[model samples]
Target: MRHTWRWFGPVDRVSVQDAAQAGALGIVSALHHIPTGDVWPVEEIAKRQAEIAAGGLHWDVVESIPVSESIKTQTGAWREHVANWQETLRRLSAVGIKTVCYNFMPVLDWTRTDLRWTARHGAKAMRFDRIDFVAFDIHLLERPAAPADYDPETRDRALQRFRAMSDERKLSLSRNVGAGLPGSADGYSLPQLRAHLETYAGIDRDRLKRHLFDFLSEVTPVAEEVGINICAHPDDPPWALLGLPRVLSTADDYADMLAAVDRPANGMTFCTGSLGALAANDLPAMVRQFGPRIHFVHLRNVRREEDRTPCSFYEDEHLEGDTDMVAVIAGLVAEEKRRKTEGRPDHQIPMRPDHGQEILDDLTRGAQPGYPAIGRLKGLAELRGIERALSHLTYGLS
Candidate 1:
C-alpha cells in the first residue's frame, strides 16, 4: 500500500507538509476550486501537483473527481457534465495521475447522525446510531413515505426517539447529514436541506443505479485510454435511507457494476469502513474478489450493531472491528505481488486511513473528529507498521 493523506488542497487547514510530516508518502487530493460538472483544466492539475510535490510528497490519487448530481440523475445538462468528467480524466491522465477515486452516493456523501458522539473511552468518534437517523427522517425532516421505508419495529422506535430529542439535537442531526463535501454542496440551511432530500424522491435506487452504470459506460472508456483506473466508492452506510435507495452498498451491487462495463478501468475504491458498516459484506473476502480491479483503499473499521445500524467504532487496534485488516491487507499484498510478477497495471495500490477518532489532546480542541491529527497519526503509524511486517513476513525480506 502507498500511504496517502486526503488533503482538500490550498485551503485545507492540514497542509501538505503536515501530511508529509505524519509519514504519508502521497497526497490524495483534488482541484476543489473547480465546480462539479466542469472540466478540470490541465493547468490547475499541474498547479496542485506542483504544490504537493513542493511539500516533498507525491499526489497519489484524486480523493474524488466529483460526479455532479446532474450526471448521477442523468438530468438536465447530464451529457455536458459527463463530457466534462471524461475531459477531466483525460487531463488528469495526461498529467500522470493514474488512479482516480469516485462515488455514486446521491445527494449527501458519507453521513453521520452525530459528528461528535462521545465514546466510552472519553474521546469523541463519529456515530450513526439508528434511532437518531430514524428520528430525523421521520419527525424532523419528515420525508414523505419515510414510515414505509422503515420496518414496523423501527417505525415505532423512530416515533419514540423523535419525541425524546430536543430541537438542538434535531438541528445537529440534520446539519451533520446535510453537510456536503468540500467542492460539493455548501452547508445548507434546514429548509434548503429539506428541499435537497426531496429532489431525490423521483430517482429511486434503480434509477440511480442505471445512472451510475451509464456514467461508467461513458467515462470509463476514456479512463481506459488515458491509463487511469476509475474506482467507484461505495455508499457510506450501505443501505436505504429516508426513502432513498443506495445502489452501491453490496457485493452484488459491485458485481452489477463490473458487468455493466467489462473494462478493467471500472474498479472499486475498496473502502472497508463503508463496506464493513454492513455485516453481510465480508470485507476481506471482497478485497480478494476485487483484487484485480481495486485502485484505491479507505482502510478503517466500524462497530456494527446487531440491529445493523453502524457507528464509527474506535479505530480498532489493527485487525479489529468488523473488518479483518490483517487478512484484507495480506490479500492485497498477495494481489500486488501477483501483479508485480505478472507485469499487470495497477500493481501498487494507494490506501489511506479513512476516519480516526478525536483522542489525546485533540479531544480538547474542536476539530473534525475524524481528521484529528493525533488520532490519524496513531492510525497511520499502526497501519504502516502492519504493512511493513506483512511485507517482510510474506516476501521473506527483512
Candidate 2:
C-alpha cells in the first residue's frame, strides 16, 4: 500500500512538510475553497498540485468534492451540479489524479459530539456519545419528529441529560454537533439546519438510494472514460443522524452500491473506523469480499462504549481499538499479492492514518480536531509496521 496523509491545504495548521516528516509518500487532499456546486477549474487543481509538489509529495487522492445537498435530494439545480461534478472528474484525470473520494451524507458530513474527550493516558480523542447526540437532536435542535426516532427509554434518558446540562455546556454541545468538520463547506445555524432538514421531507431511505444510483449512472461512465475511480466514503458513525437516511453503512450497502453501477470506476473507500463503529460489521471479512472494488483506504479504529446500536464510541489508538488491525492488513496484503499476480495496474492501494489522538504538544497546538501531527505519525508508524510484517510472512520478502 502507498502511505498517504490528508492535508487541508494552506489554511491547515499541519503543513505538508509535517506529512513528509511523518513518512507519508502521498497526500490525500481537496480544493476545499471551491464552493459546493461549482466546477474545480484546471488552474485551481494545477495550483494545488504545485503546492503539494513543492513539499516533495504528490497528491494521490482527492478526499472529496463535496456532494451538494441539491445533488443528494435531486432538486434545485441538481442536474447542473452533476454536470459540474463530471467536469471536476475530467479535470482531475487530466492532472493524473485518478482516485476521488466523496460522501453522500446529507446536511452534514462526519460528526462527533465531543471533540476532546480524555483517554486513559490523558490524550484527547474525538467521541460520539449517543445520549449527547440525542440530547442535541431532541432538546437543543428541537426537531419536531426527533422524539419519534427514539424509544421511550432513550427519550427519557436524553431529556434528563439535557436538563442536567448548564447553559454553557448546552451551547458547546450545539456548536459541536451543528458545525461542519475541517474540509466541509460551512457550519449551520439552528434555523438554517432546520430549513435544510425540511428539504428532505418525504425522501426516505429507498428514495435516497435511488438518487445515489442515478448519480452513479450519470457519472460512472465519465469516470470510466477518463480513467478515474470515483469512490464513495462510507457514512461516518455508520448510521442515520438527525432524521436523515444513511444508505451506505453496512457491507450490504457496499455490495448494493457496487452492483448499482457495476463498473470499475464506481468503487468504495474502505474506512475501518467508520465501518467498525457498528459492531455488526466484520472488518476483515468485508475487506476480503470487496477487495477488487476498494479504491482508497482510511486506516483508523474506534472503541464502542457499549455493544448496542446507537451507543457511544471514541477514536482509539490505531492498533488498540476493537478492530483487528493485523487481520485487516493481512487481508489487504493478500489482495495486493493477488493483484500483482493478475498484473492489475492499480495493484498497490493508497491508504492514510485516518484520525489520531491529541497527544504530546498536540493539545496546545490547536491543530484541526482529530488531525494532530505527532499522533498521526504514531499511527502511521504502527500501521506501516503491521503491513511490513504481513508482507514478509506472505511473500517471503523477495
Question: What does the lDDT come to for candidate 1?
Answer: 0.80
- Indicate the TM-score of model 2: 0.98
The lDDT for every candidate, in the order shown, is 0.80, 0.92
State the number of backbone clashes in model 1.
Answer: 0
lDDT of 1 by residue, 112-155 (tens): 78787787578777777787787787787777777777779878
Per-prediction backbone clash count: 0, 0
- Tens-digit lDDT track of model 2 for 97-133: 9899999888878889998899978999999999989
Residue 326 of model 1, lDDT score: 81
> Which numbered prediction scores highest in TM-score against the true structure?
2
Task: List the candidates' TM-scores in order.
Answer: 0.93, 0.98
